[model samples]
Target: MEILFYIVPALMIALASCAVAAVIRRSLRISRAWNSGLTAEARCLRTYTTTSGGGDSSVRTTVHHVYAFTTRDGRGVRFEEQGGPGTTLEGDIVTVHYPADRPEHATARPPARGKLVAGTGCLLAFLGTFILFAVGFMVVTYAMFSAVGDFSQP
Candidate 1:
């Protein structure tokens, strides 16, 4: 219906904004990891895959990983990464990065340019959708108003 034209774009734009926020936050976090001066060796404690939300329309599987590391001051930290799995395997030694003052906030080093590209991609997609919605809204409103004027011309 005509009402859908207005409602759908509003919903899409709102959802897209959330996606943009998530991508930006993730990119900033990864950028911090890459820029940190402190480094340590971490081991992948475990890796597993989980399947969910898959039905007739879509099927998806996500990989989960856990890592453990020790800082220079002999402080130990363990975390579960929620960004799916990386190339590391259980017991594999991986490089970690963290602010020297916050060794407890360490994260595995992401590949060069990976986070930037992902954030850029999300932004571009959102921009495209926004442009499309704006154009559609203008066209629909213009047509509707024109039709009303035509009817009023008796």
Candidate 2:
């Protein structure tokens, strides 16, 4: 039971670290693609919305768009990704950045630094809250056991 006190906080920290690393890695990849001139004018082929969750209050919505383009070497590529709904429409042209070798792993644009910072800050805050709760629980449990003294039979 006491092991849980250590495990919860460690798990939260690990999750936060992984999330931050993913964000940085993605940012670097996007930067490299743009700087290397691996870009193409992709056309929006179709747009769709997906919904998930069971309860009324827990419903979630995501807008996904499918795009197709031709690379400089004359390779046709098609991919789907989540994006703003109204910002793009069927037949709208958008610039896509991707690696020369893997056109499937592409992004519509570079990530916004401001949004990244805000997201990281939020993640850290969430981790901090869980750590505090775990520590508080451990302290309270220890205090209760100490006050009750040892239970032994003679």
Candidate 3:
């Protein structure tokens, strides 16, 4: 339908904006943690892969690692590291950064640039969709006016 032309692009733009905002928010949080200067040597306790989908659709596998570390105060913390600098084998040692107040919320040292890249890509998508819609609207308007011929006086 003609309405879909407007609805689809609006939805795409909204989705892209949401994605970009999420990436920026996450990046800021990680930046804060990185700047906190609290760090520890974490050990990968275990590694696992989760697979989803079958039959009709292709399966997607996500790798997750559980890491344990001790804070400066000797508090032991274990958490699942998601989507960054993943370690494939158990017992691998890596450095992690965290806020003193929130030791459980940590990030791997030398944070991955994937978030930044994703944010940029989403922002570009948002801009591209917006421009495409604007040009489309203008062309449609011009075509409509041209088809109507002169209307000033006759």
lDDT of each: 0.73, 0.75, 0.75
In the range 1-154, model 3's lDDT, one tens digit per residue, is: 3455456666776775676577667676777678788889998888888889999999987878888999999999998866545445788888888889888778765655586567656776766677677557756856876798656657
Task: State which candidate, 1 or 2, has the greater lDDT.
Answer: 2
TM per prediction? 0.70, 0.64, 0.62
lDDT computed for candidate 2: 0.75
Give the clash total for candidate 1.
Answer: 0
**lDDT winner between candidates 1 and 3:** 3
- Poorly placed runs, candidate 3 (over 4 Å): 50-62, 84-88, 111-154
lDDT, model 1, position 29: 68
User: Where is the poorest 10-residue window by lDDT in model 3?
Assistant: 1-10
Model 2 misplaced regions, further than 4 Å:
52-58, 110-154
Q: How many angstroms is residue 62 displaced in model 1 relative to the true structure, after the best TM-score fit?
A: 2.3
Angstrom error of the Cα, residue 65, model 2: value is 1.1
- Top candidate by TM-score: 1
Q: After superposition, how far is residue 60 of candidate 1 from its true place, in Å?
A: 2.7
